[model samples]
Target: MSGRLRLSLQYKLFLAFVLIIIVPISVVTYVTTKRVSRQFQDHNRDLIRSIMEQMVRAYQRYGTSAVAKMEKASHSREIQEISARLSLTDSLGTTSIFEALTPEQITESAKQVGGPLDLDVFTILTGDGTIISSSHYPERFGYKNAKLLSIAARQEGVPFLIQEETANDTILTVQAIQRIALDSATKSLIIAGGYRLLRQDFLELILSYGKASLLFYDIPKKAITRLPPGRDGNPTPFAQSPDLLKLARQISEWPNNPLQPDSGAAARPELQAEISLGNSTYMFTGIPLIGVDGAGLGVLLIGLSQADLYRLLRKMTMSSTIAAAIGILSALLLSILFALRVTRPVKELSRAVRSVALGNLDQTIGVTSHDEIGMLGAAFNKMALDLKDNREKLIQIERVAAWREMARRLAHELKNPLFPIQVSVETMIKAEQRTSTEFSTIFAEGTQTILEEVESLKSIIKEFSEFARMPKPVFGPTSVNQVVKQTLLLFNPQLRTIRLIMDLDDHLPLIMADKDQLGRLIKNLVSNALEAMGEQGSLTVKTHLGSPKVPVGAGGTSSLASEGAAERASGRGIEELPALARETWVTLQIGDTGEGLSEEAKQRLFTPYYTTKPKGTGLGLAIVQSIVADHNGKISVDSAVGQGTTFEIELPISQPSLAGTETV
Candidate 1:
């Protein structure tokens, strides 16, 4: 996970932006939701507490009022009259009334006393705490179940109040004990009355606080009974509201389930839990109901539904998720734009650098901005201009040097012939003074000498003129091997001293060329070979068709000045000549076995006015170069010291001539 974080600047920036936006949003959303939930919890606790306090006050107030009302009813005038009647019946006869009056009569007497009170139960008890007759429970006719009233009788004017639990119901009653004085003996009759706590009334109180109810665990029944349906709606059985029931059971059975009897607070019935009911959620708190005697009666389950809180939290989460998605997408788009804007200049600079490496110094980057990249581009442009200027200056220097060398060689050649002519003329002038006797012979010799030297000077001048004004070649089909054969024939006489070898391929193709130029090109190479051999070594001239796949190396001699001149005249550099000279070229190799040329000599071998032999015109190889150039051909020399020299010429097989004009 950490390794993935080590990404490029663009990605890192994107990640940074995402974290910056998303982290805060996530944290805020989470905190807000949690805080809201906590606050709801506090609010729920306060609400439940308020409801319980209301219930406690209502219970105390209602209970006190009920007890007071019951005491008033027990001492009512109607009750007193019924009491008087009971006293009269007893006074009639102690034994006779006891035998005649049935339990029904006792019940009638009690009802007549307490009937105006509209009580749920009315009963008569003897002074011995025996139930004589009951208004609601008539079956309790003879049971000694009036201990509550008997105790009241002992208290004189005080009435006894108690919550009586029976087999079928529980009721609250107030008993008024009155002593009846009689002739036979002292006797007492008690009137006890109260009302049942109906399930309907209890439920009404329970629902006064929001969807709440009372659960009473009947220990005898071993099951929880919902008192009744609350005011909100009909109460589903505890079996039906499983979520609520399960929690209620757990809380009710706390000490027995998860806590020991001595676990103190944990054993005490105060439970708070969240439950899911159907699709809605709720939070509830349970409180135990204790009697005045400090005995557990049942639990008072107080529930505050949490469905609204859950809905709020879910909505917040969804909103946060949506915000994060939008933020991430926007960040990604912005990062891409920023990255492109930042790297554009760098990419342009890189391209310029590549162009410079490839020797394209003229390539320039646009200085569109006043940033670092723009400054770098400006520097590069300045460097390219400087390089171009330096190259031109160097070419000029070499051109001037070549011209100076040509002038010096010309002067030296002309000086040689001119010096002899001057000396011969001077001798003639001196001879004329000597006498008529020897003047004729001296004059004749002088004239002959002058003519010969003049001829020599003319030859030198003519060679130079020819090199300067060399003619262009006229194209025609010509065999290179045939031309070599003819040139070799012309050198037949010199071949006797130097063995000649011809390795011309008979299958060699014809090439577009000038017959005379091709012959002259071959003749000069053969002549130089013969002369270099010093009349004893071998001279080999080989001709064959060159391979069309690979390019053959062919060019003028190593003299930059001469080669540059040739290229300029033809408007083609040595490297540019390949367009005219195709791969399907005719090759001619002319070699010689002799004291080979030094590297320096070979370098300038074909340069105009450069020659090694005395009395030799250097125009021969130069003329040959011009002729090959005119024919859209290339010429190159391969030679090593003591290993002789080989001159190879490659000409396109049948390219048309550039200049259509023919010159003889």
Candidate 2:
């Protein structure tokens, strides 16, 4: 069998507990982790969308404020005066305008208007897109500002953002243009006012709503710039990172551009993605920045750090694992305790059963509860009680039956002798009445017959007396081989007609027994073997130092001999035999090749006065059993009709000290 199948009940119960407790816990943890992860992602997505929307609204508010300021600056008195002068008509009665003042005077007027309105660029332009005067860029006073003029042609006094190239760098500006007509022929002068869009100001405005970093993707240049939230460092680090550049390109292609004018009818959801930068991760969303003319200016990326969320998830998983471990351990402990609690009674009951099997009918178990185990304990106790009671009654009945059998046999034996004597005396009386000679002859023959019958009766009575008064063994060290040899010496004369076989073990250990009784036991067994073999048979005697090959049980004559031995050894049961006593036993066997006994005869062979031979007094074998039993040994007969019989005896090598024994 596999090791798993061989596991004891306790381990099996522990595994059951693990499956019942830990499996569900693991499953629940897995499911809950998945649910929580999904929720966190959904919540993060919603939060990022909210932040993006707020950022867009803030940008819109700033733009609206800048446009309002530019509009206010346009209607200023200084700008109006500059526009009036720049729009002076020529004397040719045409719509063409002229510069009515010196360039220095026009520049001074642009500065006076721009300085108070906080404008970054204030310029006066001709109808043909030439800058007449400039506040922020005086060097470009006469330059043809083609980009501004193109926007001016399209503008209707509404403010819009545009990128302007200065001598040093490109800058984004929010500008508004207003026209000043000189005549009816469409010749006009323009006044343009705007504020510069600085990177630091843009980032500051974005950071006002949340703690997130920003990245700007300039669509035209195909470049990505990192806009840190702080105001001190270089706000725009135009580092050309390939990974960031790739992300920016991907964002630019997203269809949901929030700044698209046509996107108002559809949902302008932010395009979101995850990216790892250095050792940290970020969740980024893209919001496109489109100009008023529907031209793509750039994409603005807002990123939120995801390190805290990851840490939280890790903590949750660890906590669940710890809890599950504790639960499994607790379940295992409980299972062990429960298994012990459940199996303890069964173990006790099993031991009690073994004790009862060994002839100890007084065994019992404790019943502590009303559960099934407790009920089993109660049942075992009841069974033991019943067995003990039944055994006592059986022993009483057996004693009664034994006495009745002995009485009947005694009566039968006495009747046979008495009948012969009675007939002999009656014949003597009849001869006495006939004649002196005949009477004398009859008297002599009758007296001899009567004497012979009386002698037979005396022998029968003597045998019965010896069986009834068997003596306690005086235990001492005596060699079993020596006793067997000595006993066989008495049968040497009868061995002449029979083949004598002696297989005595020279190494047989000395046993503690009464020498006289031990010799008598061997003698009786040998004598019976000789008589069974008749005139032409074999007689075998063997001695060994071990238990019988086949186990002898209580159902055989061996068990009866053990019971008798136990009764003689202080009225103790067979179970009371010490372990050492049983281990050191010596075995002796005597066999004869004669007409073996039948099964029925073998069973009753040890019963007193139960003999099979026509003229045999069964007390011979009965006395043999009694002597062996007195020495606390066992005897059995292996026999079958026509096959011969063998009597085996087992005696302890060294008997334990009893109450009155001098040597043990």
Candidate 3:
């Protein structure tokens, strides 16, 4: 689970989409389902009320017929005869005298009475409001029921009236009252009667209304009776719908005031609740059953199965799951495609970088798009081309340096014999012009000049040979400062007009170098300085040890870093230079207070056979550069027009031993 939770970008995005798309859908589905259930409850309540409304109307019609029958019975001839005899015997015309009637007499009289077939209650009441007898409850003879007496007393002169009453037996009924007049004498006796609400017809009427499971709760008795669904003869008993009945029972117990809708305040009955019974679900609700006079009799419970609702919700869930699956699948596929589209170019660029690392500067990638990746490819190609150009330049520079060395040697070799030959020929000519001059003297002088020129030729050849066959150096711990001091001592007398300044650091460390070669390098720089000063200017030679913490440029050693980097890149094998070059490097600077060189001359200052002076061979500085390079050192010149020139050289104290190293 933890591993799965470690999210990649694509999966994280997919989860985000799932939440965005599926969460709202799930919430909406749940809310909608709840709303639908509420609607079902409200609609069912309305339906049950509609059915109850019709049931009340049916009960009212039954009461009306019973009232009509009671009224007719009161007007019968037999009832009139009895009322006349009774009235003649009472002066006040008080019907309370009828209390003397026995229960057997009342039962016998009602047997002969003609009235409604379903008369639930037949009673005789006196004019002063006393129940003489009730055919249904004959044991209550001579008793007074205030509810019945009130109906009899309130019947002033009206022919008949109806009222609702509940007897001591808890039988709820609607009664009718009427007076029997004995032939217009204004004398009469009151008769009251009613039909009980517990009749089978009443229950049948409610059950016939709808398919809702019904239960009649007897409020007074605290008993429950299920009104079986369908017709009376239908064998399907009410118990078959136990789930519905169970739900109905539960709804009946909720807080309710059915008799007076607004009379009581408890928690309003739960409008709807789900109930499970025998593998099925049902929605339950309740309605109050009240008597005609607004007395709460019982509750009418109704149950509606929830099978259809579940089916609807299940279908919705399945559809949503499938849709979510499709959405996530689509997101995953698109994310994969997008990741590949972005990474493919990066991989190609990586390969190109590797090619460059392996010194293959010609490798380039195609710029397929105008995006950042394409821009990178274009930049890579430009870099490769630049490197290729720099390599070619370095190679050309090496060739020029080689050619310059060869020309310097050739010039030196040829110039030697020519001077002497010219002098010898001139001497012979002079001899001929003087007629007294001896022929032998002319031959001897001419030959001697020629021989001298031949020896000079040999010396020039030896110099060339020596340069070409330069001996190697023998390394040792030599003081560079001491070498510079010795070279200054040798040239101090020769430099008659030149003012010399020596700023050498006595604290410089010993370097592994050839003293003879070091002396030659310093002599060449000193000679050039004197010559550039035109026989009368200051010459400065400064020597110091470089600091490790100092950067190359700030310390006048940047020439080594830049040029060494180029040489290393060109495979010149300068990588063996000591890492302590910064701190252990011995720096020498030669400055001349004379006419400075132009930029072109500075660039070719160390090129053999290239000189700015009329009598200069140019090999002097060239030889100095070669000696410094052989010691694994760097040399550079800084010059500006009209300002003097300065030559700086840096040599390491220790370097890797070379094969041809030898000491003089």
lDDT of 2 by residue, 408-436 (tens): 88898899999999999999888788766
lDDT of 1 by residue, 534-608 (tens): 869988887777532333333323322222223322323333434443346677888898777787887787777
TM-score of candidate 2 on Cα atoms, chains taken together? 0.54
Local distance difference test, each candidate:
0.62, 0.70, 0.62
lDDT ranking from best candidate downward? 2, 1, 3
The 10-residue segment with the lowest total lDDT in model 1: 655-664
Against the true structure, whose lDDT is highest?
2
- Clash totals for all candidate models: 0, 0, 6
Encode model 3's per-residue lDDT on 1-664: one tens digit a residue.
2233465555665667667777877888789878887786676666666654555555556557766878777766656555655665533222434543433555555534534345767776555545554566655645656655554565432222223333343555655667555443644456766665536676666556444555555566555556552354222333334554454455455444333234442223345556665676765566555443345556555556667767887887788788778877777776677556545666667656644443445666777778776787778789878877886797589758766767765776577678778877887877777764486787787898898878777765664555556566778899988888888998867677788888989898899898998898888888887877876889888888873233333322223322323332222223232354346577888999889888677666776768888744456776777677667667766677788888887776775333221110
Clashing pairs in 3: 95-126, 95-127, 473-661, 473-662, 474-662, 474-663
Q: TM-score each candidate.
A: 0.45, 0.54, 0.44
Candidate 3 runs further than 4 Å off: 1-6, 20-24, 76-105, 108-116, 128-135, 155-169, 181-188, 198-211, 217-307, 322-664
Off by over 4 Å in 1: 1-6, 85-129, 132-141, 144-202, 211-214, 230-236, 240-270, 291-294, 343-664
Candidate 3: give its CA RMSD in angstroms: 15.1
